[model samples]
Target: MANIQWFPGHMAKALRQLRENLKVIDIVFELVDARIPEASRNPELNDAVGTKPTLLILEKSDLADPRATSAWLRYYRQHNQAAIAVDVNDRKLTGDLTKAAREVLKEQRARAAEKGIQSETVRAVVAGIPNVGKSTLLNRLVNKKVAVTGDRPGVTKKQQWLKAGKDLQLLDTPGVLWPKFEDQLVGQKLALTGAIKDSLFAKDDVALYAIKWLRKQDQLTALVDRYHVTTEDLSLSDVDLLLAITQRLGFKDDYERASERLIFDLRKGKLGRLTFELPEDSEATDNA
Candidate 1:
């Protein structure tokens, strides 16, 4: 497998602009995919965000393991990080957003009240890496298609504030990716989950990675059942298992096509509700 790195010129400009505009921002809604929470995060946001109040939203919770999501939320709270897991399509999305924002900005809101300043609306910026569902969440909160959305990365190209209900204003920015990936496994995880462009990495490489990861987690049953492969087949090496599944799917020796199909199914939740990283796998535990 080759090194996976994608940092377009526009992403660099977006980070610089994000820093410049942080002063007017009341809160930052940092979104990450629930399935690959750690890998989908843009580390550069820490420095750019500075001391801004932030609500860590785990988007696409509907597609992630419920148990893992709850555990991750617990981990965040234990670390004093304000966070919430949400499905963008939920009717209570705006309500949840308002509640989480209020909690995170409790002290600030109290200070304003002490000064006799009554601010009704919260001004927040939705920031995250490519295709982590920033635009989709904004549209859901605002109750309209304010930003163009797609299944792939880099769908958002610019920034603007959209009115989300009566009490919230959301500033949506382009998905920002860093210049390099120090840990290539992080890159592979991102690539497999549709954060990075598929053009940057081979489908077979990501598919093999997914197979090995699933096996390690004891979650390979879904794939085996979906593809109708045998337990004897599971005993094979990762690459051999992929090839065998490819043959079972009638792809013959075309492992790349089978790899693409496998990746697509995984992203669409065809395999099952899967979370790429567990709480125990976090860097703070020295196991990541």
Candidate 2:
């Protein structure tokens, strides 16, 4: 009941499924967007049914700022949070989370033996906000792209489970946009990453955010070089930078064109692997 925003009907269904299944699951391998971990998680996930141990998988690590991801890993683990960074689309990159998850299970199995309930494999529910790469991660773990992959938000739309390994069961779900959506930066980050529908955001505003982030990363030269533009006074605001991009990218509708290109660059790594919101912005209003 937090002031969260953005839950879709399919997501409401997925949440019901998670609620029913939580009683049976051992732990949660929550797939958080590496680029926006704080924003990607749902408060309800922590408040699920029972107090459950969770292994936080910062998905799409390859596309996130390595330093920020590392710092986040340290921050979470320091608080005794089980976490790992991973490129959900690549198995080789996913090994760390798989291994880390198993380690947690192994410890749990040992402890369970003392309680006369020898739990061998771990049943973990993979939860995250819509479009946080849940399907991509599930496919890598199972060595197949079983779940549907798409560019827009709310792709999974339901609950599905897979036999990932000998001692691990992975569940891919489409539950994320909770009711409130309180923080502005969190919502903006979600929108930037495609967790929210494009129609919900002003493309010009979203595009401006991308431009500001890219400009700060010093990757404006790439955009400028690609479109033959000059960055004479690079100290412009987000809107001005986006206008420059519009002029360079040559999209008939300047705003629409710049927005598309900006999103494309981020998705394709042309703008550099960057994170939109920092930990400092966690308390801000939900901008989406």
Candidate 3:
């Protein structure tokens, strides 16, 4: 995958700022893409937020396989981590987040009550890698256009604190990526999901990776069906698959456009609900 690596200067600053501000934050809403929960998570951020109460929110649940999302939820619960899958556009999103946050902060709430403190407001930071919908989730949580929303990464450059509910406040931070991706697959997954900038990687390379992975999961049928490819096309190599798709779609000379179309359709959920990494794979990685 050409050793993909991206770490903007602002991301480094964001990490430093988050570390400095962690003291005031009561809980961390660690947002991850439901389609790639493990890859979407920044290991450095997890380490920096160590021992703090964190609610692992799998955003964009609607774009992920429902069964896979359930498995991930169970996996987190088994590991004693509070987690929930939520679609930003869902009507019950606010309530789901509120309930999950309350559960994570139950002990903290009790301690405050013991100190004779009433009406203790919970403070949390909404954090994630770029373009994983941190800003969109914040806007949804507040039910307004408070944070700038976009389809690309690095939209929110500065941090801002906003009210979420009667007793909850949230700090919205810019999306940050680590200096390096230890695993190449992590980079590929991030790139495919639009978390990484398009200019960083070749469209055909990412599309080929997506094709190989989808083939393993038996999801290439969706691709074939989406593009109306013949049965013989399935047996073709990754590059050949793209070429065939391009030719079939009348983009004979524009292979890049064909690759982009495939990627766009996948991202837009036109193919089907897909999840890249399974719970078993993540669990093994955790042990390793």
Candidate 4:
């Protein structure tokens, strides 16, 4: 999985365009999956968006563990990074983001006000890796289906501008992923979160990774309940455990199909709201 290279040609072009358009962007709305915030972030963005204000949107908050989400919010606040957890269905989504962007650019807004320039409009670019819900966020902000949306990655392939009420003029860009993942675990996390295309990696590998991690956390209750697997079954090896669950799921010997189903259930929150990484697991937290 670490050797997976998913940098499409259009993504490279989008990065170039994002850099070229950064001068006019007032704030960057860096969206990341709430379940894998650190893994979902595009590291190249910081260099491209130097000195610009940024508000991190933890998209799909409703689908992640609430306690873990709260901890991540606190972690970002401690690092002086402005972040907010959001679900596309939240009524206050627009207002909350507008306020956060204004707060991040408060000094700039104040400076503009002193010069007798009054403008409520904020120019922000929505950015993150694919399938992190950029299109859904855009449609919700504008209150219209201006961008194509899907459950898979790479839905929005081009850049376009859309408006949200009276204050936000959003630049919606295609999801950008770095050329290569330096950490094997980061790649696996992305795969498990659906940030990477399902075809790019083996479904069974991701499923086994999820099972091992969840079992360690004792977070496999939902899986057991859904599949009717016993506590003794949980003590089995990862491969044996997956096979047992596969048999219970009535897939016969087709563990591959069972693997795909398991991955789907994990992503859809059928198993439960789970967080793949914590602040303590981050090297950045150590450095900070």
Q: What TM-score does each of the candidates earn? A: 0.97, 0.87, 0.96, 0.96
Ranking by lDDT: 1, 3, 4, 2
Q: Each model's C-alpha lDDT? A: 0.91, 0.73, 0.90, 0.89
Clashing residue pairs for model 3:
none
Output candidate 1 Cα RMSD.
Answer: 1.2
Candidate 1 per-residue lDDT, tens place, 165-192, comes to 8899889999999989998889988998
lDDT of 4 by residue, 14-55 (tens): 989999999988999999999999989998877778888899
TM-score of 2: 0.87
Better of 1 and 2 by TM-score: 1
Give Cα distance to truth, residue 29, candidate 1, Å. 0.2
Error of 1 at 28 (Å): 0.2
Off by over 4 Å in 1: 283-288
Tell me the lDDT of model 2 at 97.
64
lDDT of 1: 0.91
Error of 1 at 279 (Å): 1.1
Give candidate 4 misplaced runs (Cα > 4 Å): 283-288
The prediction achieving the highest lDDT against the true structure is 1
